[model samples]
Target: MYVRSQSDDIYGDVWTEEKAYCVEVEVHRVQDAEDLLFSPWREVSWTEKKREELRENLTLYKPSFEALSKVRVLLLGPVGAGKSSFINSIRSVLYRRVSLLPIIGSVSEGFTKKLKCYDIRAEKGGQPTALTLCDAMGFGDSEGTGMTLHDTLAVIKGHVPEGHKFQSEASINFNTPGYRQSPAMEDTVHCAVFVLDACKVLSYSENLEKKLKKLHRMISDLGIPHVVLLTHVDQVCHAVQEDVQYVYTSRIVQERMQKAAELVGLPLSFVYPIKNYASEVSVNCNTDILLLSAVNQILQAIDDASEDYPSAPQEAETKR
Candidate 1:
């Protein structure tokens, strides 16, 4: 929308030089897709009643996989993209209190260094629920940093045992003491969640994008379901910052959703824009609804994938 002018040195001499016209930059404007809208910046359709219903549904549900005991979801993203924060946010909602189980802090060189897994339980000191989240080291711009392909495959195939420390210098081998030689269906990852910051959706570095695309192809070849979580929506959009419910209606969020979908080669429906509990002391209904909704969809994907798993029986239903 604006023009920039500059001059280049024609006759160059340190003391005296003549300038010539250089290239002018202009017409570089970014615009959101034009879509007809009836409402102007209002709360999302998800109401308090709906939030309560979803909370109850999520808390009481159990996986129907007769063979597998829990559905495993993998979390992957770059440094400081809020992967650990997302898990903590989900725990806060399910526990109905402030839970900081996963230690989250500033990403100087990626906070997590080992493979970790958490069991989502119904209540405090109760049995584990259907969902299980596994987190790994964050990816970095430079090579030989973060997780390598070998390590990623190890986790996806369920060979990399929980609490396996990631070594940037070398990948884990079968001879490693704690490596799981034979991983069961329950141990393998069922759904892959690519967590990304909404503020950087359109500005991801080239190196990061290449790594993501490479991982995407490997995940697709396995026929595993993929979902994208666009976090930190409040930082990008002002309206969403004021009220979490306005995320759906904000143009900025919608654009980020579209961009994230294209970046990860997923459909719009699979891309979820959510706000994690960054500094909140208590649980918010709207935030809980958004986070729980994403988890609900992931559980559904796990259920769908379980139908074709060889270990599962034909009647993969929980006998109440």
Candidate 2:
């Protein structure tokens, strides 16, 4: 029997007949065991510098043609999917503080009743982002309760003006006030984002899915770019709920993204997982990174679409 010393390495010490038979051996491990409950945290290649670079890229984004000054992305989703909350999330990052604008909260029905366009401005009062986010009323479970197909088409064609209230009784017509008789590329939607709740993905209503499919077909016919924003990611995946950095490694999160792609008929790359500022009163870096990543992809798609504009050739030369 031997006395334990403070300088002794408990795991490295070997026992003999003369010493205490507390046989100990050091085991060198190359990697950790796989966690069945949660995925291990993996480092993302993008750093704060990369995020800032993307933000600067967006700030200086220019359309191939001079007719358009900004890329407009229209947000479409059912009530409670956090469309307004998503807008607030992005604004929070840009302002470097919590933003409660666009007035988002829980309710029996959608709170936004008008076609509102939001612009992002730098915290230090520099040039605003070249992207415009258009927020429309949430789609309802029943007919004549929320945004109608006619209203969506009007907006897609750049006919619906900012602040035009949606009338459940009927659709906007040619005689509607503030209607643009001849809408230009700048006034039209460059990309469409369908916001969905990751928690409700496995249990999405058939009616809502059908409506989304129909809208997808219409948007496809117009050759407009579209994507899906899978929100509430934190509520779905346990690992992500614990720490959002594990989002990319979690199998559950990957499955939800796959489901979103299947539902919207979009590629997996076009589906983004995001967590909005629903219950949080302050801004968070993890949340901001997710929102900005989605925004950056949408901006790239908008830029691609702008390059293929049929009228760009003549319009570009005419301007010169």
Candidate 3:
């Protein structure tokens, strides 16, 4: 059952033939649970004579000029927990179509958001994408420099317990290519977003858990694709913790953030609750539900890395 209809505007389809997806997927358990069987209004193949030209083109697609740019996102947080106001609220809400994307890497004029990177491109063909928004200067608000904790224990000793070190690894090279001087921080980071601030841990009664296990061992080497962006969540759902008891310190910081994502294995990762584009009379510059839950967690990471994004089994209208 598939009914087709679109009246113009897939948002400048970029080059026309249209194709932009970025689903990496490696939960092994659950952070998404197949996002309700994939639902972005599903259906986007269009071929039967363009189904009468896709109902005239279909509002030129607009998820705020969309740009997951193929998952390379590294928006680690701590400093003011806003990350340059969520990259200036996605370029002032798509202003200049994501600041005319050549790779959005030049927002910090002074306040340390250095080593900038947005570099995203692809609509009709696809290839150029970087997306490195490392606001790690205030590493957990202490102002450290780059990835610390001995660079996350030299990449978690080559992924702990992943097959007993693959039979001794012969010598210890592990695809070495000049490590990380600036080859763009040794790339390959699909998603490590963790910007939680929920009112500074809802006043912390006792849920820091050794500072979230030292920021989860300094970003758990992106283990199991961590993605917790719980910014403010509009003051944790419009404030009412047992009539102001403060919901038992936000439920012990959500059971120590779900036991630090199950001791870094990941039975739960992708959490969303954001609010803060800006303008709540700037006490410290807030706006929350975690900035629209970090804009719906990067549009669900561009709809789980879209491959033209569609898969509800098939039901545009029961396909006529």
Model 3 per-residue lDDT tens digits across residues 65-94: 143223344465444656555655444332
lDDT of 1 by residue, 1-320 (tens): 33333454854452233443436634553332233134644344478887878777777767767766667888998888899998888888878886877468785788988889988777666777778888899887755778886788678877888888898787889887688877767778878899998988888888778888788887776767779999999898766787777788778788888888888878888888888998889988889888888888888877787666556221221111
Task: Please report, in order, the local distance difference test score of every candidate based on alpha carbons.
Answer: 0.78, 0.77, 0.38
lDDT string, candidate 2, 1-320, tens digits:
34453334545544333344345656786332232234333345446776676656666777655667777889998888888888888888777678767467678688888999988766646667778888999887655668887788789878889999998896888889999877777788888999988888888777777778888988877767899999988887666776677778877777888988887888888898898877677866777777788888898787776666565322333344
Query: Candidate 2 clashing pairs?
Result: none
Q: Which ten residues in a row are the worst by lDDT in model 3?
A: 159-168
Better of 2 and 3 by lDDT: 2
Question: Candidate 2: where is the Cα deviation over 4 Å?
Answer: 1-43, 312-320
The count of residue-pair clashes in candidate 1 stands at: 0
For every candidate, C-alpha RMSD to the true structure in Å: 12.9, 6.6, 24.5
Best by lDDT: 1
